[model samples]
Target: MNSAPTNYKAARRDPHAVGTDSGKSTRGEVSLSSPDAMACLRRIAWLLFFTALTALGGVRPNSLQPPQQLIASYNDEQSATLRWEAVPGARLYRFQISEQRDFTTIRTDALLLPSKSWIRATIAGLEPGKMYWWRVQAIGNSGESAWSLPVRLSTNGEMVGVPVERLPADRSVLAFCSVLRFSWRACDGATSYRLQLSPSPTFDRQVIERESVEPYAEVVELVGGRGYYWRVQARRGSESGQWSPVQQFTLLSLANIADAAPSVKESQRLRLLKSDDPVPVELVPNPVADVLTVRTPPLHEGGSITLFDVVGRQMLRMPVAGVEQAQIPVGQLPAGSYTIVITTSQYQWVGTVEVLR
Candidate 1:
């Protein structure tokens, strides 16, 4: 009795194209040449189609399946890795890890990994003797899913092999418009460095690996809106030293690039420490542009002082042993915040230092 709705889809016309309702035949017939003029009739046809299909029942939602078989890895010095069995129909996964059982002391942020096959995330800069925890969740076009049961991780063993520093200074987000330059500190007694990058922190998917002896490398093809984990190891003759810490960084698109320099958001969580642990030694010239002097207590006098860019890229390493206080040259360093981890036989402490040019 009435004209058809103007919402029906046409094979060629835009979905929202409007249709006229002024034409009608005495026999109650309608002629709709345009797509939108046949919405009601198309709906009736779809109803009949889906109705028949509905009689056959339906499939389960994709979000119902969760990632399983979660595993932790400690393959490199100062690093932790989480791997899990991929969930079917999952387009992305969220991986989180923390030192606290309550999830209040997380070190890494939610890592959104694309691909149903992505199943791992590796993080570096883990101090020895600390208990860590981690979990994962799957995401799809449907929605985010329930988080998996958390798991605890125990330290494997004391770090060994000559330590090389990873760069882009960990967690360094780059603009997609710029070429990504990966660098690390050169290791003594090493002939080359192996650089590895991946969409999944575990290097399970979309992996890129390269080898160089210059202590630095570059890449030109990482897309925006995804997290990447990278690491480096020094190779000498038949021996490869322990890998530098794993670093996670994001590449952003052009819209986010307001200025010539890419926008960088540095995330350095509060220094993780036990309640009764000794506070780290004081460092003079914290907002220091040049030289930095560390006043160490007797307990940490002989410990090593190491500085890392956020996301765990080591920037500087020096022995603070046999001295009341240690001073290191930072005259040529760029302006930014850095983390300092002081390690001795007894305990380890972390703090932050800022550099200004």
Candidate 2:
């Protein structure tokens, strides 16, 4: 009976020990479900959802803008027209023009309407021999876009006259000598024409010749078998046109003369040659008295002589109408050296004379 009671007490104690171990296991699992751990898991899930939304938004399609094609045309010597293709979403266009190649110095700017694809505006009062650059910019609701490719335009520097279709016939090559003749169509307002001969194209150090109310000019005494350049200008009062295009000619040797016998009379030929040569002047008595006599070689016709002081101040101007000699009254003149210049339709000559009395 004592052994049976002892076995039953041992069974009851074993059951109670099992119940305590189960309770400890439940508490351990509950501790892992703390507030901090749950909050961390919620934050991770929200971050992933936001990242997906942002990625999807970036892939949406946006409007595309491209540069427009431009076309340019010249309206006149100093003006031009600009046109371009229209942009679909553009509200306005900005136009810029410049004289420099890099567009650093802008000359003009205009804001144009978006509805029109072509615009005509005169670029007047522009200088000659200059190049211009132009471009267009499209403005949209979002922002201003890139500039169009630049277009280049050039203005005419040579001025053409009326009634002159072609230049005068080129001079014939004379044997043992070279002859160069220049001709041009006449301008409406020109009272005289000036011819310029130069070794360089710029004509900075030029030899000038003049003709009164004539359309043709002859240049003689040129070196044979040598190339010479020439240009022409028309003048009326203070207004003078731009220089014409340059022309080149070569002289022929005397052996190349077609006919040895002169077809043109000697007097006529001398007149023609003298018209292009510088005039010759002689002052009588190097040391002059109160009155001095000036003599010039006989001019063909329509020539003149002018006198100036040593300092290039004009002293006297007289017309030459079949007169070779003139008496210059220097009674009240200052005691100094003076220069006398003789100018013919085709020539200009200068000589110095002293006044000592």
Candidate 3:
């Protein structure tokens, strides 16, 4: 009976049993399907996946760098120098100049050292009175940096000699109805000149004439017996640098021609009795066939008369007197409209006349 009891306890705690009272089992019989064990395995799997995602997020795709600094300085009136701070790992530096604010390839490019920090280059052939902009760009193996701020500079105009020596001499006056010949020494870099002639030394009224790159200009078709003043200025395209000292010249009297052509038959010619005074005028036989006649009140001595076409072309010039009548020849003139001008040294009278065939 005691042996049988022992057999029952042995069966309850068998070492090779599928399930045991002591909760100890063999490897194949172990209950690994418990909720707590399953939950622990899932947590391990999630940790491994999270670690892989974090490593990928931390890796940088590409590197980004900053732009370099630019500096510009003017060496002289016609020259400029450009410099820039060196950028580490830069392939090359591109320099650009532009007349406009926006940078473009149309502007001149000055290539600088790829890795060097300092570069000096002279900018020549620039126009005066013009503003220019410059900037630098840094290029590297990774990518190109942003462009630097633009630097602005202006060039000076061409220098001109002082006291413009080539100007016409003082008291050197030109005469009306005379071909005025003007010549002067060229300035150092002057390509051409702008010639202006007027009736006053101050150049209030200007007659413009342009000459070639040469230093001379011929002014013909001057109004006879009229006092005219003139001045000259130098130019290089839109740049009008400096004006010469105002030169004063009084147009010579029309009567001067009488000395040379005394043989020409002279009838009653119009003349201004006043040298530089205003006078009223009246015309008779204005539409006459053969002779045109004009009459004016007695005038001061030294007055003159001038005849011109509609286009201001001088046709005839004569002296004036306190005479009863002045006669003009119309036989040789073509049928058209003409202007009869009577002027004194200080006064002027203008009238229109029609010529009839």
Candidate 4:
């Protein structure tokens, strides 16, 4: 160690001091006060300031890329596995599934960590046999990325359920018409439905057979004054459900209905031949005690009148036949406001009636 190390610390403290043994002035040597050194220090200070700003949320990276290749890897009756390709620089992922195409009603929304390139999530408690749409997005320090394109999936399985009839009640008489519409309640796990109409209750003589993805179907060119039978069956993949209970309906013709009603006046029957006019109906005795007289325009095709209580319970239904005036017995009904519905093959009218004491 000899005469001790040169005092570099003293030289640094004294800016004008000469470098020991080097025989150079300190100004020429690299030091904290030098131009180059000051420039480097300034750069370091700016970097530290920016780092602090980033920590305080003043700066962030660019938006992440959206996830892609979304698919339903596995699906069953009540659960499904959703998978997608990972996005670069994504710190987290967001996945969503909905029964609606617009995603208005979300079924599942989850946040997942981005630990692998292939991201997968298993969602349970899904409705069986229903269709669903799913999408994904990536989230990083910058912000969330745009939503990926939606993918469609169905949970149709091995088992299918029977469909229950909804409209055109069994054993009911329908007005004479060329077309009839039939509807049924939705069935679980059904991808398609089959409808069969027959002249016989046994369905041995099929008049029309239709396959549809919807729950309702329209059959045209039906014959009047005849009875028909209809049934529905649900199918999912290769599985077929049992046929629904057979239902029957009768289409009543004008002559058949006229034979069942009281005779109408000749003047009223002449109205049926006149040019089109707004259907006019009259109720006699604003509040009747024994019977209510309903005078209607001539019904050449016949019609029916249905009475309902305030709670929507059916009280009576009578055929209008070809008569312009018919009597309804309301003495036995309760003294409350009632609803009268007049139904014809082509038109229907609704009005209110007050039954007073």
Candidate 5:
């Protein structure tokens, strides 16, 4: 039989310490049935269970949430800005850029410390005209989170001499009209042009498309009360150049002219009129040559009269100065249909006039 432990205090503190009393195991052995010994064994078993659960994919706080809303915008032909929503409690972030969607190879791998709700990363040294993929991962005290969904972006191609839009200025607002005009500078070596209009900036869906030899085009009967985006592409034979930068405009209904026009007195003779309402202005000589005359009812306040070509390029602008009649010289202009915009203190009018040689 083994003797009783000599160091009772030490044995109570650590059951394993009881195996050797006075530095010799032959002196005494601890009783496993002791309350302290049983408590120590339970703690060891609990630690083992917890570690096994962790290795089996438990206690994953990072995987429950990750960065989101990844968006990329080109800063130039060789660089871009990547941004995304930050994850709460994230201490650091890992962002990667890759040429392959599956991320077989990484072009950029970087780490960042969380600072705000939105995180921004600027990446450079990219090749033009190539598509790239990017994603982000958040890391916290627990572990690293799953990667965010990737976003794809393309760099601008060789569009050095591409056409530039001239008319229907970007982000312009216009009143309700059946016809929409567009114009762009002519591109060299281009035999034809393609004009496209869409409700999306990405041009995923096009509502209007026209092919023309000239640099200008027109679309009619586009519904008002919405916004539209347009771009132009130059083509020569079978070759085509990249699309020009997009331009956007919003069209409002004539009844809501207050939004498009300056505020005017309600009692003025040139009161705001509905789209179907007729204006009191008239143009003499349907196909005008040399000189065109605009006749209208007497106006209490002066307004401006303007002429626009098929491409919505302004050809003439003059103040009516409260006059009932105004004359415009069309002899120097090219033969085509032009739009006339008459704006008074209280009303606005849009009409088409045919100019002759």
Candidate 6:
């Protein structure tokens, strides 16, 4: 039969001592129910619980909250920038972009540390017009927390080229408007446009900079009777064009749509190509400061050459008798975007021209 040991006063009273006789006067005798032994058992059980938690799926300090208000914007059609709120005490962050919500086809997995000032990442080589989803996870010594809520972003699909007709035609006087919506024609396979709104004519100091997949953008928060300038440029994948000429419009209490529309009717304008495939007349000195030359034509009917503002206002018109094409003077025309309409009695050929001074 096992004999019960006698308790040592110093050792049994100590709850934290490692050795049963660790106290100043404690000896080797210690009872099984001593406080020191009980404390040791409790410490072992706590350690076991902690080890099990780390090995299992229970990460410490609770699951990380979903990325705060994830925002996605595109500087180029093939690339995007993502921004999120930084998580406190997160030593590591993992961001993933995928074509599918389930992340079956992952495009990018960006790793970031908590010390970063901005919790953002720029991902490139993405397809335009495709739908993508992104999520973020916070990781620390304790383990990884739950993934953030997925954010959906639809990439821009814009046309490439210079802007065409605008809501407020060049040199337009507004009747009334609090918000301005600028519209332009779309080019084929274009992915996006860069826009600038400025208070100055030269756009030296722009008030707004925007990138949009659509051909239109609406700007708000403007004071009445204030004149503003705006311009846009478009780009495709791996290619881009120059910025368009600036157009100015003044604000007022009047908001008549007709006041902003071009003087000429859009639907009434006739546009005919050489053979319907390849363009016929290619305007020479495209950014014509003085005379614009119209070359290339099988004009059979002594066509007349006419230049119209972007809004469709016929700016210059000259009758051509025997020549297939001719040089037209536009020195008197204001600096803005224009269209060259070369109409022969047979077919009306349409082309684009710009006046830069």
Instruction: Please tell me which predicted candidate would have the highest lDDT against the true structure.
Output: 5
Candidate 2 vs candidate 6: the TM-score winner is: 6
Per-residue error (Å), model 4, residue 177? 1.4
Per-candidate alpha-carbon RMSD to the true structure: 24.1, 34.5, 35.2, 25.5, 24.8, 20.9
Candidate 3 lDDT over 1-357, as tens digits, reads: 111111111112122222234354332133444645534654575466345535655322123243444443444455555555666765445556678878642235433444344444445445557887877666545545677777775665545442254433334322244455555667654535777787777666656555545576777757756666666776543456677877654554666633422111244344443335354566667665545677876656676556666655555555656665666545435578876676554556666777888
Candidate 6 local lDDT, 1-357, one digit each (tens): 022122111112222222334333222223555545555665575467457757766566545554565655555656666666667656566777777999875544545545434465555555668888988777665666788888876556554467775444454444333445677777554557788888898878757888776877767766655677888887664456667888776654433322332232344456654335476566778888856777766555555666666665454555566665566655545789876666665556666777998
The TM-scores, one per candidate, come to 0.30, 0.26, 0.29, 0.37, 0.32, 0.33
Ranking by TM-score: 4, 6, 5, 1, 3, 2
Report the lDDT tens digits of candidate 1 across residue range 45-124.
54674465356553234445667777554544355445677676554565656778778744444434443343555454
- On TM-score, the candidate that comes out on top is 4
TM-score of 1: 0.30
- Model 4 segments more than 4 A misplaced: 1-158, 259-357
- Residue 8 CA displacement from its true place in model 1, Å: 76
Colliding pairs, model 6: 158-190, 158-191, 159-190, 160-190, 175-254, 176-253, 176-254, 176-255
| lDDT value, residue 287 of candidate 5 | 82
10 residues in a row with least lDDT, candidate 2 = 6-15
Candidate that beats the other on lDDT, 5 or 6, i.e. the better one: 5
> What is the lDDT, from 0 to 100, of the residue 148 in candidate 1?
82
Error of 5 at 213 (Å): 34
* Candidate 6: worst-modelled 10 consecutive residues by lDDT: 1-10
List, residue by residue over 1-357, the lDDT tens digit for candidate 2.
Answer: 111111111011111111222233311122334545534654575467446645655322123253465644444445455556767666555666787767885555545555544333334434456787878776555445677778775655444354342232122121222333455677753546778776556767645565534677766645654545677777543345677777554444434333222222333313221224454555677668544566777765765555556655554444555667755544334668876656665556666667775
* Candidate 2 TM-score versus the reference: 0.26
Per-model CA lDDT versus the true structure: 0.57, 0.51, 0.53, 0.63, 0.64, 0.60
User: What TM-score should be assigned to candidate 6?
Assistant: 0.33
Which 10-residue span in candidate 4 carries the lowest summed lDDT?
6-15
